[model samples]
Target: MQRIHNVTQLADLDDDAMARCYAYPRQLDRPWVRANFVSSIDGAFTVDGVSAGLGTDADHRVFVLLRELAEVIVVGAGTARAEDYGGAHPDPARRRAHFQRGIGGSADGAPPPIAVVTASARLDPAARLFTDAEVAPLIITTAHADPDRVAALQEAGAQVEVAGAAAIMPAAVLRVLAERGWQRVLCEGGPHLFGQLAEADLVDELCLSTVPKLVGGAGGRISLSASGFDTPMSRKQLVLAEDGTVLARWARR
Candidate 1:
């Protein structure tokens, strides 16, 4: 173990610089799960029952950049419900960076699709995830989920697939993405989902922004699992924003 010292201020990083900093590995044969989350100094990932309440402008900037870097965004149904998740809407700058990576997009430069993981397949068909999407959403659920609900989502324009028998397996989800050539995977979590991926050893990288605040409440941690395990990770990058938000990138060691 080594002490981290001599850190420098990293402020006003231009679009290109931010993209370069968060770019996925150049060559990837399989899905590389990268989770992006914002947390308070006291380990609270949410305030007033939503994560957006915990993020600052600096954190939101990195969040958008990370979304541009990913080919697919995965989220838990619970998070999707809480955040009222919608399809990705990449701005011109983000779209340009996305295509510059040699990843072809739709004629109108649609952003990557959001894939929702749910065991119950309980999602709103009228939600923005389906209505406001340029690309159709992908729904990954278990075979035992209510067939009617699964069919409802399928009818609502989601490409539904069964990835598990009774639960949504992390490996199965990655396999589905890998088969579709989605190598750069980004997961926006609601804690429980992050816990599953971490437990399964499927998480490759984590981009975390430490918001400068102390929200003392019953907010849970950034990850939750029935059991706990340790996977050593090395800090890949550290950027201190002027607004006091600290952006950190960590990779499994």
Candidate 2:
């Protein structure tokens, strides 16, 4: 992993450091999209593992702002399981801002839908995700998943669908999103999902939040592994944003 001391070192930053961090790629006009994540100096996505504890006051503000801009939030099942994700409900102030922009509904309305990608259909419905968030959940699965299991989630009111024959393919997921008229999709990942997306050439941009501290553990890293391409599949540049966070944008060739 690359390390930098401060946010100013990034070359592409704009006046509102937050806006620059979430800027979309020019090539990604619709359907496909990207967002990045990073941690704070403590080497925690949270104080433990949740995202809520990773940022400064400014960082948290920008984090919510990014969610407001996205039409859907895509996350791997492991992340959903670990984080106990409920939905992509932005704060009331941010929701109002989205309403002004005609993206979200009134305060009483539901938040943006969440797309959960999983290889197996069997997951704990009692997991904090379903019980906590108000928005309905969308499950993307493979044909390998059990039909009865899918039915259970459906009975519980989730919208479940098969996206690939064996494992969920990034391309098929994007196609499904396009069909639903979801143009801006934000992917919050565990390393495995990030590796799959990067290898499949599905990601358009990244909003990495590079924290200052490091934990030399065998488990955590920005990516699981590099792609097996004979040549480079893409290139990225970093931009320094608020509170020692670095946003890295990668465009796939």
Candidate 3:
């Protein structure tokens, strides 16, 4: 791995940066998925208890760009709670880009929906994830969640549905989104969710921003517990941005 100091280095690169280093090809059609994350040099998911510390100006720009390209943004409930994320509407400039790219914008006019995966139905109804956007949030949960809570979220203007049991199974969630015409899903993860998706063979690409600093703590990692997989998963070469970040894509063999 190399450390990149500027985004200019990636200006001339093509999809190879996303494909060769991240393992995602531009040729993928519906049901295509990607995991976007940023990490410290030492592999910590956070510093001072926040992920914003790991992001650079270029990283944030790239993150927004990725969001603009996605049809729907999928996130684990824990990540949503931690980050206090709202809807998935790109900013004005990015929204225009999305419209040009054939994403998020109907002739009638509607923004893209944000998908939050949770097993527990205990999230706060007044959270930013529900209040921050014009469009209603989509809460994807398992059968184990509380019925009353689900109804409550629904009443609060969220589209709540039970998609799987135990954990929010990635394959099941992807199938549901695919049915709704959400062919390209972007997962902004919080580690555990990334692990679950990878274990289920649902992740097709990984967009990683490698930060320059390092946090030596043992608190959080770029991935969650590894108990679900029967064996280790492997990755394929994708693209390497000029800033030293890498994009990798992988699939089940």
In model 3, the runs with Cα more than 4 Å from the true position are: 1-8, 11-29, 92-110, 226-253
Report model 2's TM-score to 2 decimal places.
0.75
Across 1-253, the per-residue lDDT of candidate 3 in tens digits comes to 8854323345565532422223223444568777888887788888766688778755675676676566678888888887888886665554554455454323333456788889986778888877787778888898999898998888788888788877766788888788888776788987888888777767777777776676687657767766756544345434455666554434444
- Give a tens-digit lDDT track for model 2, residues 1-253: 8865333453344324544445443234466567557665544454455565455544555456667667678888888887777767776565555555454323443466888888897667766667666777889999999888888778777888799888877778787777777777788887678777777766766666656655443346545535563224344555554456655555656
Q: What is each predicted model's overall lDDT from 0 to 1?
A: 0.85, 0.65, 0.70
* Per-residue lDDT of candidate 1, residues 1-253 (tens digit): 8967634456756777777777787766788889999999999998888997787988999888777777889999999988889999877565664566744222345688999999999999999999989889999999899999999999999999899999977899899888888878899997999999999999999999999999999988888897899999998888899989999999999
Candidate 2 weakest ten by summed lDDT: 6-15
State the local distance difference test value for candidate 1: 0.85
Clashes per candidate, residues 3 or more apart or on different chains: 0, 3, 18
TM-score of 1: 0.93
Estimate the TM-score of every prediction: 0.93, 0.75, 0.79
Highest lDDT scorer: 1
The total number of steric clashes, by the backbone 3 Å criterion, in model 3 comes to 18
